[model samples]
Target chain A: MPRTNRQWSLARTPRGRLTTDDLALVESPIPQIGPNEILVRNTWLSIDPSIRIRLSSTTPLGYLPPIRPGEPLVGLALGTVIDTRNPDFAVGDLVSHIFGFRDYAVIGTRADTIGGYGLPTRIDTRGMPPQWYLGPLGSSGLTAYAALTEVLQLRQEDTVWVSAAAGGVGAIAAQIAKLRGATVLGSAGRADKVEFLRQELGIAAFDYHDPTLHESLAELAPDGIDAYFDNVGGDHLAAAMDNLRPRGRIAVCGAVSGYDGAPHSGNPDLFQIVSKELRIQGFRAGSYNHLEGSMRQEVGGYLTAGDMVYHETIFDDLTQAPTALLAMLAGKTIGKTLCRLTSE
Target chain B: MPRTNRQWSLARTPRGRLTTDDLALVESPIPQIGPNEILVRNTWLSIDPSIRIRLSSTTPLGYLPPIRPGEPLVGLALGTVIDTRNPDFAVGDLVSHIFGFRDYAVIGTRADTIGGYGLPTRIDTRGMPPQWYLGPLGSSGLTAYAALTEVLQLRQEDTVWVSAAAGGVGAIAAQIAKLRGATVLGSAGRADKVEFLRQELGIAAFDYHDPTLHESLAELAPDGIDAYFDNVGGDHLAAAMDNLRPRGRIAVCGAVSGYDGAPHSGNPDLFQIVSKELRIQGFRAGSYNHLEGSMRQEVGGYLTAGDMVYHETIFDDLTQAPTALLAMLAGKTIGKTLCRLTSE
Candidate 1:
């Protein structure tokens, strides 16, 4: 074999809606493996809302450089190594990387480092699906763990209200809070998600498309809410402010509602925060890099003991990647949406 | 001499504006003092914005009960004892009690107690004006202290931004932060207040009526702010969110901006909180009742050493009480406003 490769590159800057034509699939010479480099045959790719932020000139994160046009779109993916020069990784082993949107990736030991480390390892998936690495057992899992347990210091007996409860991060967070013995309540867009949260996840209460969400929450937790895990910002955050009890805590994780539109203009009733004596904090999972070991241990144990459950919406082929991404952005997909690049 | 007593009672509830006619002064027969009661001649009464909340049925604090149609309006006051049946208090002793807006009060031994004990022997005026006991060394002072030092855990080297810098709590909070070696910047309403904060209080920087407050704050704090003491909570809060550094802390103390009007609507850019990893907390002075001894000690020492300064616009008599309160609510007063009932 002459070592063939295929990669997708950004074709142009997107103004409003991005189309498949905006990404160009190109045939390129396979990269040569250097000392401390590993060549991976990409198997799966994760599409997230954070990618939309990277696509534009504005990022609320305010730290990373803006993505330029005519460059490769960078994101997370799972792959198996076909060739390796790095001593830490074997040729037959699997790995995850901050890989570009490509069919194959050549990852160096020092390349794609963020918060001062390379990508995570791909341990035995056992009988579990490989796509689980992109959902609950991966970045989304770490995000839920860090925000709930570390940043918010969630108590087992506390009442938790989560927004976007059907999305990847929100779904896992609600389950984790329930597993921790919390009274969990979640909000989603459709009736199916509401039923999923109530019947499948054993959530204490669930609401969908309720215009009186604030009043509904008040009625549900008449004694008042102890903590809120916010994924959808804007109106949801404002409602959380009103429903929070004295000394309530909020962990701000994501803001999918306003990501594609003009920023929300109304100021929250901050007076409630003052009079009720609440605490609101923001967190990113990347900041908790050291906790990866503990998180993996705990979450892995939970999965093995049947205390945790997860769902995934899989797109069969790489050609459907654009549709999957669009569905995820529109919040039409349930749980974690993944694009399967190759058959097992 | 025959004993005579005069009491002021609420005659009617004002629809929009309150006047002296709303309160009626009537002479009453002096009742016999009970076994656990002490009769005191009201000397000084402290009027505050919190009193306004108690006047309405929809108060958020839920502390004082709503005033009855024809009952005496009660508040925090300083007085002198003329007769005592309680063993803990003696005649001729000066005391602070939760009974005011009247000429005399039959304070129960259980009612006039401080720290579960009877009132202290004497108040130390210490070259500072006696009115300060109602402003800086009083409940308002404790509120600012508790929120900034305890709840917010403000650092000595932190850059602090304060809103309503010329008002009672804000003026004292700004000075306190400066004393703790923090770089203090503040926002007030008028040019005179800006000058007062800069020249009189020695604040590092200040702005008045700046249409571009957000831009001005960004320029002042190029590195970003470490902590904020929020008093005026609408746009000021949004501006603070934009300028906060990572891991920044905000102590929400009051929301005078939205106090009298309908609650302001709209989703503020709370996503900034998540991206910056900020911590925002609300605090009440009552929560830190354990710190009363230490807080008074420190504030009293500062006053005695001439390190802290305060101002009060005094209304001459009980008839002018409503006007003084309206002045404070309208932002007409420079600092704390109180009503003096007697020369003694």
Candidate 2:
């Protein structure tokens, strides 16, 4: 058994493009489980861009507090209980929790009930990959579901645009909107990802780097879009406003375009919101935990039956978590970005 | 009786501050009404900032169309039927319609059916002034009601901020929100307008020109506002975004700040929207005609009982319509700005 535990802690708040100097990986001894505690070996770590917001020292106004220097970065991870003094989590039980960037964790909790890392949710893979629990069935999946059904309240035959369509949430959002009988037009960064969307997702996809995004949007959605699932705010948002039909709806999932605190000159003349009668709603999926079961059953079925194909860029070690996040934020990753710790 | 009808026609689209040069008051002989026609004598012309958007040659997309050079400006107005060959309408009945900056209008239509100027529905004033159909009981009133009940869906005990607080819509909105038991803070242009908000409407009010607008907002809303009724949407919008509580709602009525086509630099960071989980909905009351009856009954009661007081900047004649609009746009007017075409 491995007694040494390796973990990454935030070294400093990142200013622009993140480098490894911003995070420090250190080796520590794995703590033994006490009574009513469970010892787990973390096998996978989920890397997300939201972690960058947490790494900001000043901490944005209304989001979660900043992670202090030298504190282990907190995020979702898949782990297996190797040893336990608690009754419910027996040896060899598979679970997911906020063991974070660490390779091992020992948490004191009632063995009979599950703790809330939100997605540590007990999922039945039903012969599918458990990793599906972290991607198509994780926070991204739930966010896509909520944005489509509740936020956008998409009507059949509505034309939709998904920004960051190559990402975890946007990819699924496009598919779900398509499933709801709407035309889905999406924007990604790379040509390969754009191809992936058209070929695999069967939707109109364009690259944001295209010289004429407006023309591309016009060609793709000639009649104009009825809904916009906005993951990239700035120019993408402005373009959507220009192309949105009257009484359009915008489900604001993320602001990746302007997340680094840079000037985004393309903030649309908000008057268009009234003139076009648009509804822009900003949402956090963690607040929609009530819809978890239904989303799991619906999106989970698509994953299980091979009706929905999801791709991910996975790193082999925990040291790659920071790099993975940078890559994802840089729009280099094709799907959900994750770091693999143990080979299942 | 006047043999000729005088109407103001657009001379040119103004580049900056609107002047008399952009509009020309022209006179034409009144045409005889046909058997199906009704002749109307225009009494009061409603002057709103939205007219500026229409006067722009490059019509701001999606709202009302632009007025061509030599075409009369179309808007809401209070008038009376003077001659009707049609059976449904009788001479001397107060009416409202889009007679368009004119002193007399003769139309060929069944006196019974209403035209779609979007308003001028047969309103029962019940001893209240018929011009009330253009102010507190008009589109502005319906706008306030719809914004509070439908757009914001404001929760009780909410702290609200209304920008352009002394104007037609904002004045009524502040009162309605207060009646709903919310702590309402408002911003107007002049000291007198601010005083009107505090003294008559019972809302905490401030002047936007105050050098300490940000400090004043912070002091007024010690915690944070839960909702915003945005009429002037430049710095006030930015300030509101900075001071909104989590899950705050913004009902975007208009953007008078940029109505003159000048650049406004105070657009809020889009990330704050996602972080705070705000819902910003833009609406026009014309689109929400469904709420007319309920709003009239409830708000009408307040107006009849004198529980709600409304103020207006009334111009004495048709020639003042252009100047009244410019004054209203400059925030020089309190409450509704109307050109009183005649004295009964």
Model 2 steric clash pairs: none
- Candidate DockQ scores, in order: 0.52, 0.74
Q: Look at candidate 1 and give me any clashing residue pairs.
A: A266-B266, A266-B267
Candidate 1 local lDDT, residue A62: 45
lDDT of 1 by residue, B269-322 (tens): 687887788888887666776776777788878777889867677887866777
Compared with the true structure, what per-residue lDDT tens digits does model 2 show for residues A1-344? 88798888888877776678989987899888899788888887888777777777866677877888888787877888889887877888778776668888786663322123533444466776777677778778888999999989998889999999889888888888887788899889999999999999988999888866789898899888999998888888889889999889998888887655455648677878878778999988877878888998888777767778798889878777778887887888988888898643
Task: Report fnat in order of the candidates.
Answer: 0.76, 0.78
lDDT for each residue of candidate 1 in A1-344, tens digit (9 for 90 to 100): 34667666667665665667766676788889899888888888887776765666566644444566777776778888888888888887878777747778888866355543266475578766676767777788888889889877999889989888878888889898888888888888877878877887778555645756777787777777889998877778888887787788899877777664446534466777877888898877778877777877777777778887687788866667777777887878888888888543
Quick one: best DockQ, which candidate?
2
Which ten residues in a row are the worst by lDDT in model 2 chain A? A110-119
Candidate that scores best on TM-score: 2
> Which regions of candidate 1 deviate over 4 angstroms?
A1-39, A61-65, A81-93, A106-133, A262-267, B1-38, B61-74, B84-87, B106-131, B261-267
- What TM-score should be assigned to candidate 1? 0.87
lDDT tens digits by residue: candidate 2, B1-344? 66888899999888887777999999999888889677888888888888888888876567888888999877888788888887878888788776658898776653322223543344567888888888878778988999999999977789999999899889999998888788999998889998999998988998878866688888898898999998887787888888888889999888888887666758776778888888888888887778888998889899877888888889889888888888898888999889998653
